[model samples]
Target: MATLQLSGVCKSFGTTPVLHDIDLDIGEGEFVVFVGPSGCGKSTLLRLICGLDTIDSGTLTIDGEIVNDVPPAKRGIAMVFQSYALYPHMSVASNMGYALRLAGTPKAEIERRVEAAANVLRLGPLLKRKPRQLSGGQRQRVAIGRAIVREPNVFLFDEPLSNLDAALRVDMRAEIAALKQRLGTTMIYVTHDQIEAMTLADRIVVMNAGRIEQVGSPLELYRRPANRVVARFIGSPRMNLLPGALVGDPAAAEIGVRPEHVRLAGVGHGLAGTVRMVEHLGSDLFAHVEIAGVEERVVARLDGGREVHVGEAVSISVDADTSHRFDAQGKRMAPAHNDRRTA
Candidate 1:
């Protein structure tokens, strides 16, 4: 495991800047996940760290050693890409130890490392099988085993499960979680999947438009986003935004209420709206209500067994204590001293 530091990091492609002045610190053996939409430069940052690409300007330190000039082979970092890229003709054992063999390692050492990695990944029984003979999940394990055999100081994963089906992704996610506990190595994962970021990361780094938006534990980002961008991105179904004027706060720009915090009330009780649609999941139900003045439909989470029908007229109320207020610039607004429940 290794600690990593990035100071004043900046990068660009020709005239377009891809990463701004970014600074971050990662502790030894910590799992940090980078999350952002496409074109947010998360992958570029990973490439810079792994020596696959040159940093435009910044200091990248690994275990107190500056490695800006280090080659990929000497960086003591192993990266698992989205594509397994396993050689079809080679057996699992040969594929796992390919890097060591290329570096002129002793045959005995390579075999020992391969065997150990296979055992840890539960791939020992399939060592003699070719890539074509294994399932997708098994092939991914082999890719992970390849990285494990190197015993690198840090591991980098760039959406390693993107190619798998939904069920395989979940199963692979569990295996990766178990791997983290078993190996206790520093890991940096990049993904657009919220569940992966929330479950696998010790802390999540949220990026947007070439800048670091927020870095915090999953719940921190979900409950107290630094800005509107983060507030809108962290949750599933997303937080519903209503104009502040509708809630007796004309001074504020908008109020954010999570779906779970929104209540469907009797007609004429609160904001009047029409239910546009209803979704029934196993444990929860969601209603999309279209208020007269609100531009977008507001989503409300209800108990699954509760009956709600599309086109039904309903009133909605937001819990003032749990709701959030934002200023015109999209910054969170503090609650008034006179009322803790009001923003």
Candidate 2:
């Protein structure tokens, strides 16, 4: 519905900088996710966009117009926070329609808009129930429904599913994904969960220590991280980093490999190690192998059916084509001519 852009955006609290030189372009109807560790300024950036916090410098634009001075209510954006923040005294319909009412909309129009949003969220049947009568997920739906009634140009979600249980988080994730498809509103979501960032975003903005690290599609960041920090932060079990000497690459400083790209091989064929730990996750097996010369443990993902045990001797083969090479400065190195096939 709208394009959001940030240029050299910076924010701070007192004298401590929270965001530094942040620049991003979010296209119309784009689901862009901001992901990083705690204290990484993800939420601060979201608040700046929502007008909850003012940017100390640079421009904030929505739909090609400067909105740095605009108030949150006038900025045409709706934020769904981690807390439901629904009024316990109000029924579902009243809570959802409250915003329209505050704007002096006619009672009939308020009812119409409320019912419309309820229908979309499947909250129609519970319109008359109080927030006290609802479950956690239902309350969250009410919160989302409240936002929907506003019909804003952009949606800002700040870890909206963090309060839910694991099962409900998954369910709510699917629901939010469906909501985005149905409305096609520009959305900027802030979360620390990489899985949510990977699955929900058209593009993920990876952040670290108040600075932008890399911005790309889920697979792009996973397959080719911009640097070592991103390489280690984006994956589960994390990528294994071996010294260039151990990887037989004298020109490189380190070689990185994802667990899934390494396979079990016969003894004396590849990097030999002792299986330090084995994790069976139904469909996949993750073996943390302790190599002789590598400082960090190397994890190899294999078939779950493979009977591997702790302390077992195993050889792990790295797919050179799939491996990532980094220079001494911790920057990703250009692949060798023959290794270009790894991508």
Candidate 3:
């Protein structure tokens, strides 16, 4: 295993800048995920680390060795791409051992490594099958097994589960998590899927427009986002942004509250609004409420069934301590007190 580090990394195509002063340190045996919308340069950063793309300006180190000019093969890293790039004619065993064979490893060693990878990935029964004969998930596993046989210091996965069906994606995710635990190898994954980042990463790097928005643990990003963009991006249904003048001292131009934090109140509640819509998600219900004076929509996540219905007048209340204040520029405002309540 190896620790990967990028310092002052910058990349551009022609005159168009894509990454700016990127700095990140990935610990040995840690799983770090890069997540962002398309065109955010998450994949570009990964390619740079894999040595597939040259860096414009920065230093990349792996296990204390500067490797900015190192070729992909010499970097001792393996990349599993979005597409399962398995040779159709080669059997699974041959496919997994092809790299070793090409490197002139002993035939016995190649066979042993191939068999071990097959057992680890549960591909023993399909060793003789070709890519055409395997399911999507199986083909992906073969691709991963091919990487494993190389015994790389670091593994890079670029949207490896994006091609699988929903059920297969979930199953493959669990399998990959278990595989990492068993192998204990450092891994860097790139994906736009927030759930994947939240569930699989030790720390997530949220990027936007070629720049990092925030870096934190899943729950940390969800609970205490550094900015408005991250606050909305990390949560399901997203957080509700309301336009309200500060009611007291240390007030900001706008306030942000999560759906779950907005509670239904009786007549004496803090904010009054008309329920616009309600979505029942089985375990929870989300309501879109329109505050009278504000044009922005406020959402509330209610536990169980709600007694309220659309078009009905409703009052919502938020614990003042839990609200996030934001300036006009969308930057976060620190809470006035440290004793803010949360549910």
Candidate 4:
């Protein structure tokens, strides 16, 4: 395993700058994931670390050695791309051993390493099959196995599970998590999927428009987001943002509360609203309510089952202390004073 560090990393293609001055430190054996929307420089950041692209200005250190000018082949890193770049005619065993063969490794050594990686990835049963004969998930495993056979200092995965079906993606995600724990190598994964980042990373680096928005554990970003962009981006179904003026303090600006945090008021309750829509997800239900005075629609996640229907008048109340306050510029203010529920 190797520790990776980037200081003031900047990249640009002609006049358009894709990456700004970025600094990050990844410890040995740690799993760090970079997540962001497309054109956000996540992939470019990975390419910079792998030496596939040159940096305009910055320093990249791997295992305490400066490798800014090193060739990709000599960087001690292996990248698994989204598209499984496997050779169509080569069997799994041959593909896994191709890198070693090109490097002039002995036949016996190549077989030993290939067998080890195959065993780890559970590809031992499919060794004789070509890429055309494997399933999408299986082909991806082969791509990963090829990298494993190289015995790289760090593993770089760029949306390796994006091409799989939903079920296959879940299965492959578990496999990758298990593989990381077993190998314990430094890994950097890039993805646009927030769920993948939440489940797979020890810490997530949230990027936006060639810059980092926030870097924290999944729950931290969800619960105490630095701004409105992060609050909406981190959660499934997204957190509801209602347009409401602070009754007591004009300086408070806007209030933000999650759908799950909103409570249904019985009879004479809190804010009155007309139900716009209700979504039934079997175990949980979400109500989209339009408040009389507020312009934006508020969403409430009711526990158990649905209790209200469309066009019904209802009252909604949120634990004031549990809410988030955002300034006019969208920066998060002090958290509302409420008891936090444990996940």
Candidates in order, TM-scores: namely 0.96, 0.96, 0.93, 0.93
| CA deviation > 4 Å runs, candidate 2 | 338-343
Residue 238 CA displacement from its true place in model 1, Å: 1.2
Q: What is the lDDT of residue 142 in candidate 3?
A: 97
Q: 1 or 3, which is superior by lDDT?
A: 1
Which residue pairs collide, candidate 4? 321-336, 321-337
| lDDT digits (tens) for residues 266-296 of candidate 2 | 6787778899999999999998999888898
Residue 118 miss distance in model 2 (angstroms): 0.7
lDDT tens digits by residue: candidate 1, 208-258: 988999999999999988778788878888889899888767777988888
- Clashing residue pair totals per candidate (backbone < 3 A): 0, 1, 0, 2
Pairs that collide, model 3: none
Deviating ranges (above 4 Å) for candidate 1: 337-343
Better of 2 and 4 by lDDT: 2
Candidate 3 residue lDDT tens string, 82-165: 997998899999999988887899999999999999999999999999899999999999999999999999999999999999
Error of 4 at 102 (Å): 2.2
lDDT of each: 0.91, 0.91, 0.87, 0.87
RMSD of each: 1.7, 2.1, 2.4, 3.0
How big is the positional error of residue 183 in model 3, measured in Å on the Cα after superposition?
0.9
Worst 10 residues of 1 by lDDT: 334-343
